[model samples]
Target: MFEKDQDKEEWTLSATLESPASVIASGFGLDTAVGEELIVVKAIRGEIYAYETDLSTGAWLLSAEVSVVDSSYVSSRPWNQARDIPSLFQRVFLIRLED
Candidate 1:
């Protein structure tokens, strides 16, 4: 949806995560609502990827590049006894689903 006087667009969640770390999502919704879309995707480690939506097949049919930003170094040592501290992340992308 778009406002008549504003040049902005909107996204509404057409799907939801099926398991742990459930996050409400929409392609267009309020900023706070859309911001929650990443909770489920950020639960895992390793490479993550995205694809362009393929309208012909009704899918996100193209595999985009995957990027890994590991913070294992931060969790490498024990919290109390470790010599070095580990890095952390605010988000992680794990699953991809089409609605």
Candidate 2:
């Protein structure tokens, strides 16, 4: 998580997840297994985002907006299927405006 420092005109790190395993276990109600692959899903102010990471190197792979309904997380649609939709950042900005 991050917060913008208006005076500095930059984003600052706010908080972080100490244990991704615990978070995934609680939030998604799934127990991780050895050598299992997983994607982390985070909800910030009711908006859902997913982060894919390389388990071996801890490198970030991708981040995308996701939809959650009835405890299910829907992955982003393929580009070909979502050509008409606004980009993720644009949609997030629009949501902030609505708020």
Candidate 3:
């Protein structure tokens, strides 16, 4: 999750995920930090990615376990003007393989 440093507000990135896979976040040109781990989300074409921060090179390289959820509740709200309303909303669980 990325937030504005000045006001501490949550920020959301708009992305599209056609396949279920790990992505690198770098194109957004923002740094992602969860505790001591820092990363970058890169946008390639219409997709967003998450990349591991390279301490030696000062760059964000590809890493693992970053999932992009399309049509998620976090991404959807009030309603989406582009798509029809969902009939069945199911629960979602995000699990890390090698925590």
Candidate 4:
């Protein structure tokens, strides 16, 4: 689900990836059979909210946020050191702005 309020310059986006393994495999070249779920929301001011969950049980795994101009990400849960933040954003979100 994605909504945009043009007059207010506000927008929200939500997506569910059922086949996260395939996507990750293609995007990062990592081979794994684990199931992962992700949800992301962005506000007009440049704050991005991301959530990761268990695909099977819908339990929350990790929650994080990042500012458009900042690379420092804050996570509500302990983050996995093996995952690279920038690469995940590029491959999963692929956010872009156009005039």
Identify the leading candidate in terms of lDDT.
Answer: 4
Go through the candidates in order and give the clash count of each. Answer: 12, 0, 13, 0
Candidate 2 per-residue lDDT over residues 5-44, each given as its tens digit: 4564333222233343322122122222111233443334
Q: Candidate 3 vs candidate 4: which has greater lDDT?
A: 4
Q: Give the least accurate 10-residue stretch of model 3, judged by summed lDDT.
A: 87-96
What candidate 4 gets wrong by more than 4 Å, as runs, is 6-8, 13-18, 22-37, 41-43, 52-70, 74-99
Candidates sorted by TM-score, descending order? 4, 2, 3, 1
Q: Please, what are the lDDT tens digits per residue for candidate 3 over residues 1-99?
A: 333334532233433222224332222222222222323333323333334434454322235556443434322422112132131121111111121
lDDT of 3 at 25: 28
State which candidate, 2 or 3, has the greater TM-score: 2
Question: Model 1, 26-66: lDDT tens per residue?
Answer: 22111111122222222123322222223344333223333
**Tens digits of lDDT, candidate 4, 4-74:** 55666554333333443332222232122223333332223434344444334333333443434223542
Candidate maximizing TM-score: 4
Listed per candidate, the RMSD to the true structure in angstroms reads: 16.3, 12.2, 14.1, 9.8
